[model samples]
Target chain A: DAGVTQSPTHLIKTRGQHVTLRCSPISGHKSVSWYQQVLGQGPQFIFQYYEKEERGRGNFPDRFSARQFPNYSSELNVNALLLGDSALYLCASSLERDTEAFFGQGTRLTVV
Target chain B: SQELEQSPQSLIVQEGKNLTINCTSSKTLYGLYWYKQKYGEGLIFLMMLQKGGEEKSHEKITAKLDEKKQQSSLHITASQPSHAGIYLCGADLGGSSNTGKLIFGQGTTLQVKP
Candidate 1:
């Protein structure tokens, strides 16, 4: 079991630029959710996708979006980034809506 | 705004001691979950309490939810260095329109020194 895998372990971008982080869910899992964790804070839910369709969205602005691919991989895209966007982007996978979740190491995004 | 509030913001204990962290929510939760996170790491789900007055135990940790449905506590017995981490409590509202979306507390950082 490789667990959930997130790409671009760390990234740096300037304000107003756009960045896309990716995640590969655990094998045999079909639900993926994105969360943003600022320093010294608990992660805040962002978006959720299951079976290639969006299941739910959090309080994040419209500038943040995500999509789950047919193969159960997910991509989180953030546009018009601000310094506040600098945080750890976490991806969690679940077998289905009814089960517990497994999280990845997360992608650290630093916006200057 | 976060409806959930966690207590003691941080705590330090000697190895082998016991520690308790608390979580309180303004709205009734259909479910409450506890998670542990090491420094700069992802969250590890510890336990989930769904019904009021529910209690669950896992290894050295025990979690209890009050009958009022407004508060919960996580108690770790014989804490070890491996148990040092941030403890977070989250609530699932289980609204008619949403089920899994959770509201998290600020988290309590636990440090166990040998």
Candidate 2:
């Protein structure tokens, strides 16, 4: 089966602009989570959605938000982007909550 | 303070040698996960440990969890170029519910020389 898949493998946005990244979880998976990885650092959790409900949220600002669809796909949106937002946005999916999660290739966002 | 701490920010070892990396948590860990990532890429799941003193191995890699001490270690025997990458430890902090929210360490970058 195909692993978690993400769209727009690369993106470039200007400061104050908004951007949306997409992720399609593996078949049969129900939980999706988003993470941001800065250069030379490990990923930081942003949001987690299980069964289409917001299960958990990280310490990110209000500019970051995400939601999961009935089919288990997810979208991550960043508003009023800042240069600090330039990083790798990763999407992970698991069979259920607290299970082993598979990650996508990630969308590299570059804020100019 | 960082919730998770990984030792040896980076490692450079010759092939055929063995190396070990550690992850220490300040808070209790309900579950500990190990993942590998290439630079600027996504993470690849390696192993997960839930029980105290539990150890698991795959190929030449072995991981052990010590719940009492809130520490975990990853050891690789006969390291190869393929083993080179950024090793990260992610943990689900102990709480009333398992939200699947993982807080990760700064990561340990490993470089193997042939």
Candidate 3:
């Protein structure tokens, strides 16, 4: 079975622009979460959704948001992107909350 | 807020040598997880420990959880080139919700010298 899949694998956007990254969870998974990983740093939590409802959010700016679909696919949206927004966006999926999460290859976003 | 601190941020070891990395948490850990990530790749889950003094081993890798001390350690024996990567330890705070919010350490980068 395929693991969590994310696309497009790479992206580039200009400052003040918006970008949407997508993720398709593994089959039979019911939870999806988003994380941002800057170079030389561990990933920081962004948002987590279960059963198509927002379950938790991290200490990110209001410009960052995400939602999970009925099929358990998720999309991460960043508005008013800044140079600091350039980083790797990772998506994870699990059978349920608090379980082991499997990650996708991640989308590398570059804002200039 | 909970935080995880990993010791020996990076290490270089010769092939066939053994090395260990430690992860200390500021607060009690309901569950501890170990993951390995190669450069430009997503994290790969290694193991998870939930009980105090629990230890698990996979092939040449071993991980231990000391719940009483809020500490965990990962050890690799007879390391090989394939063992070179970033090892990260994550903690579950176990909040009212099951969001699976994980607090991770800075990570330990390992280099295996051939």
lDDT of each: 0.88, 0.92, 0.89
Better of 1 and 3 by lDDT: 3
Give me the iRMSD of candidate 2, please: 1.8
Taking the tens digit of each residue's C-alpha lDDT, what string does model 1 give over B1-114? Answer: 668899989999999999999999887876788999987888888998877899999999999999988899999999999999999997776542232367789999999999
Candidate with best lDDT: 2
Candidate 1 residue lDDT tens string, A1-112:
6999999899999999999999999999988989999999988989889889998899889999889898999999999999999999999888886567778999999999
What TM-score does candidate 1 get on C-alpha atoms?
0.94
> Cα RMSD to native, each candidate?
1.7, 1.2, 1.5
Summarize candidate 3's per-residue lDDT along A46-93 as a digit string, tens digits.
Answer: 998989999889999999988888888999999999999999999988
Clashes of 1: 0
Clash pairs (backbone) in predicted model 2: none
- Residue-level lDDT for A54 in candidate 2: 95
Cα lDDT for residue B112, candidate 2 = 100
Where is model 3 chain B poorest over a 10-residue stretch in terms of lDDT? B92-101
Pick the winner on TM-score between candidates 1 and 2: 2
User: Model 2: residues >4 Å from true position, as ranges?
Assistant: B67-69, B96-99
Could you give candidate 2's fraction of true interface contacts? 0.68
CAPRI verdict (incorrect, acceptable, medium, high) for model 1? medium
User: Which 10 residues in a row give candidate 1 chain A its minimum summed lDDT?
Assistant: A94-103
